[model samples]
Target: MDSEKPREIRIGNAERTTALEALGEHYTIGRLDNAEYSERVDAVTAARTRSELSELFIDLPEPTPFGPGDGSAALTPAARAASAPARIPDRREKVVRTLNLFAGGGTVLVFLLLLALGVPMAWLVFILLPMAYGAIRIWAGPGDVDASGIDSAEQQRRRDVESRRRKELGY
Candidate 1:
């Protein structure tokens, strides 16, 4: 009869429960510090989950030095990935077009008002008045952000909401 080498019995699921109970006892009796106890306990718990632990084997070092294989070529800066292009604004273009339409409409309305009020042809000069006023107001630059002018309550609420959104997104 041949006497062969004895095989080892791998620890099973029930053994895991006993191990955990022992680990908890060690913690409760002050045999280990909280941080060390938790780390060791987590390690044993992690060891029993086979399929989950299998992921830990990926690209693991084998106690030997290694580097990138010599066959592959490295890419230069100009050959790297490019960003997606920005689209130009159609919205602002339409706003300018609408402003032109508003100017023409204002002229027609002024002419009609003069005729209705029984004014003479010389009143046609009034047609340019609103357009000139609008040009001067626009060229004077944007108005000041005076606290007394605009209602501060709603503006404060909008700023708070924007700040909260930024914080929640972790930016």
Candidate 2:
């Protein structure tokens, strides 16, 4: 009990019992079905002090026994987490990155082959030089992914795979 609050006592046992009976009647009339009525009854029956009862009633509707009353209660958080997928590790992604890096390699090899086969200087300058530049552009060109809304976790996984391929292929 707060020492600062004014308090009064019901004068007799009859008065207290009558007050409790009246409150119970009011509760029963309030459309509290059996489950709720029983839960509140248990709370009230077990209450040892006025403060405990106050705590029990703090913004709470009558209680009900725990059950799958709603669909939410049926599934656990761990089940939700497990159902959500982890990122797919892209095994074939390395092949695309390798293709990008080596798209230029073929042009280089062809130009070299042409040069060794005594292709004329005028043809090499007009054809091979432009082709070599095009190859470099392809190698160092813009990436497949644009600088847009890439999910970072997936991007990191893809980058890791591409880097592994680069190392393996001695790029």
Among these predictions, the greatest lDDT belongs to 2
Best by TM-score: 1
* lDDT for residue 74 in candidate 2, whole number 0-100: 42
lDDT of 2: 0.44
Please, what are the lDDT tens digits per residue for candidate 2 over residues 112-165?
777888876634554655565567656564544423223456455545543453
Q: State the lDDT of candidate 1 residue by residue for 1-171, as single tens digits.
A: 446944433445554444444444333333344575455545555564432222222222111111122111133333322211122434434455556676667677777888888887946556566667567557654543222232245345444543453344333
Residue 82 lDDT in candidate 2: 46
> Each candidate's root-mean-square deviation in Å?
21.5, 24.7
Instruction: Name the lDDT value of residue 42 in candidate 1.
Output: 57
lDDT of candidate 1? 0.43
RMSD of 1: 21.5
Q: CA lDDT of 87 in candidate 2?
A: 38
In model 2, state the lDDT of residue 133. 57
